[model samples]
Target: MEEYKIRIVKTIQYIDSHIDADLSLEKVSEVSAYSPFHFHRIFKLVTGETLQSYIIRKKIEKSALHLAVHKNMEIKDIYWDLGFSNHSVFCKTFKKYYGLAPTEFRRSAPEKFHKILQIQSKNGQVDTVFSQYICNIENLLNWTKMNLKIEVKEMPEMNLASVMSLGIANVEPSFNLLIDWAKKKSLFPRENVKMISVYHDSCKITPLDKVRIHACMLLDERLSKQEGEVFPETIDGGKYIVGSGEVTLDDFEQCWVSMFLWMNENNYSTRRTFPYEIYHTNFKEHPEGKMIVDFCIPVH
Candidate 1:
């Protein structure tokens, strides 16, 4: 599973760097090291959208960002640069996806424009529109008031076994795979195990299909490479700001957002290492179905 996720990540990265170029299935599948047929199926299963749809959405999104940030650039130029063949095609596709023409969207508030991209939900379902998702995320901000505590501490180096998931909504499968592997290896007895999740990309900055989340667990002694796709890595020791709380999966994203906001408000700068979460309560065993987690963000 890690191998498949890594392939998708690499393919998405390739697409991101070459968004203006031709991105046919054959080309993308080649980058992923999977045959076109197999790649198409797995890509859809993992990302909640067919590969072509993802590419089109990304191209349109890029055009939207260009429209919002580059006010002086011509719409035609933006469309062309984003790989759209012509103005009419770009306008039609953009309006269909975002419900707003480029010119009109540019004239409107920037916040609304940023919310234009539709979210690709997991389970092959899109239950809410982009605006509704934003509202839901806004509502989650209230979770910060529920006895959240944060402090700064230094952490020691540790070994980890991990699996990467391609997007936020698609993280559960990776976690499940890792847990199943651990169980099979008898790496249990909760007290001796530490579960952590490392986020490789910020959703706010990266496109959804390109985001990466690493589901990890600490390993005491080095074990030989396991059969399946598990990654063995070491996290460097560091000074970090730790935020602890009981939060449902739905509130997790907002928790991180609030932590970053807190750091900004308190005049702390984040370090180069990726922010991670240390789970104090087992996910399935949470009494209230809310995980007890410590969000650890490396600080200078």
Candidate 2:
């Protein structure tokens, strides 16, 4: 898994740097040190998207933001600069992905795309943190980087309905079991119920097959303890450094490392508590390309 993750990081860096060039799977596999045939398999397992699909989406997505925010440039110039080769191709792809022509999208959604670019830029700070730690030839060759910043804030304690699952590493299974358990116990009230997951072990340090996960749902005034062997633990909510981003399974290590660095830099500490995840989006609702999970950690 470590080798796979390393290769995945290399692939992302290669695409990021060569966004203007003709980036093909064959070329990417060569750059990432993988066999051409196995490249797609590993890419899918790690990032949940094909290399071509991800690159195209990212290019369109970023170019959309550039067009939306940069009013000084003509829409045709932005399309040409994005390597679309022709106006018709650019317009077709842009409208297919964003549901509007370049001009229409720029006029109607500049503010929305601007905020996305801001968040994405903030998220790219992981590369800066990596430069502080690693110094090696592979680091140069791979350019593995993550960029993210988090802020600290306080939250009040909330009740939760939780069910411990034996399949700890599989997050989807854990959440499914928790929801089913809640349903069986008739404790899934509609109001004020928020889904949460606690990360008890570091995936980078722990084996991916055995990492621990806890699935939970916030309780409201109407919720009461159900009859079963289910356990409820208090999550002492106080000051917490909140970190949120969409990351692939392979990039989980970089995400945690960045968060730890952010916490230490900000002088936040905790004696004993597992950081929790508020799964704001699911894979079924959004394409795997856009799924996001927000991570929250309590601190002193």
**Candidate maximizing TM-score:** 1
Task: Tell me the lDDT of model 1 at 179.
Answer: 84
> What's model 2's TM-score?
0.46
Which lDDT value does model 2 have at 127? 61
- Candidate 2: tens digits of C-alpha lDDT, residues 18-87: 7778788788889877656445544544454668777878778767878877877887777776677888
lDDT of 1 by residue, 1-300 (tens): 134334556677687668899899889989977656445655554455777788899898788888887889999889878878888999999999889988998887475555554455563223353334334334434456564687888988878898988987777888888889888888865575788888788765577877998888899875557558787867778888888988888767556756765565466787788888888887578767887889988888
RMSD of 1: 14.4
What are the root-mean-square deviations of the candidates from the true structure over C-alphas? 14.4, 16.2
Which parts of model 1 have CA positions greater than 4 angstroms off? 1-145, 223-227
Cα lDDT listed for each candidate: 0.74, 0.64
In model 1, what lDDT does residue 71 have? Answer: 85
